[model samples]
Target chain A: MANFLVWVVWLGAAFACLVSALAVVSFRNPFYSALALIGNLASLAVLFLLLSGEFVAAGQVLVYGGAVMVMFLFVIAYLGDKSEESPWSGGPSWQIVGAVLAGGAILAEVIVVVGLKAGDFLSSPKPVTRDFGSPAALGRLFLTDHLLAFEVTSIVLLVAAVGGVVLGAHARQGEDPTEVHART
Target chain B: MRGPDIQWYVILSAILFSVGALGVMLRRSPLIILLSVEIMLNAANLLLIAFSRLHGREDGQIFAISVMAVAASEVVVGLGMIVAMGRRHVDLDVDKLRTLRG
Candidate 1:
């Protein structure tokens, strides 16, 4: 019964993930797309939980679904509807055809490689420790085996934060900073 | 009691990645493009965690965390550029932004 429950949850989350991902692409409004992305991220977090990645699942919800998506929504609202793109207007018809073909080709290749060629090898899940994906285990790895990468990621985040402030500052070449601020 | 096969997870990840690629190609809006990129990154994270489970290790989870950090930073910068461009009254269409085209 537990196994059956797992299968059902897995199927539901997987379907939700795919559908919302498509919704993210197909939605005409950027705000709707951002909302769809949040759904997609949430479903992915469910999948993460099923995989026993408790900490990762929580992080996915907190970071992607919460923080990053709010930023996207804010930007979309700030830009307003003026920047909206008509689905069929901008590019030539061939771009859509090419994109669909390319996507199909990629999907086919992966299905062939992972589903057919390596099927037997990946058919089973290995046994895991009781704390395999717990926060403590991940923290130890972050501090030990992956310390350099962890430190580097922090530096990268700092740089990106600085860059965002610099680029987002309202002052342009000739515009007075105070005036720009006042205008907004 | 075991869950679904690891192969199924991999296939699902692949499908999501392909859909994301399609979005990036077909959409003209940079915001959607960035969102699609996030989808692709999440697909990769899914695969990493699946493999981590298959191997009974924490390494994949750690890597996924790093990926999240990187993705967060990327969004910060990308959105900043988009806002900057919008403020300048520049065209938001990616195709027409050819000033850097050489």
Candidate 2:
């Protein structure tokens, strides 16, 4: 019964992810697109839970779904959703065709490469230990083998925060009241 | 009863990645392009976790966590640029983003 429930949750989350992803790219309104992305990220968190990645799943919810989605929504709110000149007008005709062809080619290559030994690749080597996805195991790895990488990530985030503030402040200082009024 | 195979997850990731790539190439709005990039990043993260499970290793999940951190920082800077550009009444189309002087 527990296994059946797991399967149901996995399938449902997977479907939700796919649908929301499509909505993200296809939605014309930026606000709607941002909302779709939130859905996508949240469902992805659920999928992570199914994969026994408790740490990653929590991070996905907090970082991507919560923080990142708020950033996106803030942008959408600041810059009101200006409808495109023509809906569904993605780009120049040739650009659209090229994008489609390139995406299709990449998809085909991935399918071909992964299909050969996919069965063996999918099966787990052994039953997962109870502590596999626990915080203790992950924290131990972070402190030991992955310590340098973790510190580097922290530095990167610090730089990004400082840079974002600098850039945003500069932009605000130079803002033209005329343009703001025009938009309003 | 058995769980869903890793192949399903992998294939889903690939499809999502492809869709993201298409959005990046075809979309004019810089914000949408940024959104597409986020999708691609998530797709890659999904693959990492799947492989981690298959190997019964924790390395891939750790890498995924770091990827998420980087992604957050990236979007922060990108959105800042977007806000700056919007202030100038600059075109949101990435093709015209070459000039920072405005």
DockQ metric, candidate 2: 0.55
User: Per-residue lDDT of B1-102 in model 2, one digit per residue for the tens?
Assistant: 156888888888998899899888877787888888999999999999888887889999999999999999999999998888787777677655554443
Tens digit of per-residue lDDT, candidate 1, span A1-184: 8889999999999999999999988888888989999999999999999899999999999999999999999999999975688765668789989999999999999999886756556876777778889999999999999999899999999999999989988755886433443423
Query: What residue pairs clash in candidate 1, if any at all?
Result: none
lDDT of 2 at A91: 50
List the DockQ of the predictions in order.
0.63, 0.55
Interface RMSD of each: 3.2, 3.4
Please give the range of 10 consecutive residues that has the lowest summed lDDT in model 1 chain A: A175-184
Model 2 off-target regions past 4 Å?
A: A82-87, A171-184, B95-102
Q: Whole-model Cα lDDT per candidate?
A: 0.90, 0.84
Error of 2 at B26 (Å): 1.2
lDDT per residue as tens, model 1, B4-101: 88888999999999999999999888999999999999999999999999888788999999999999999999999999888877778888776654
True contacts kept of 1: 0.79
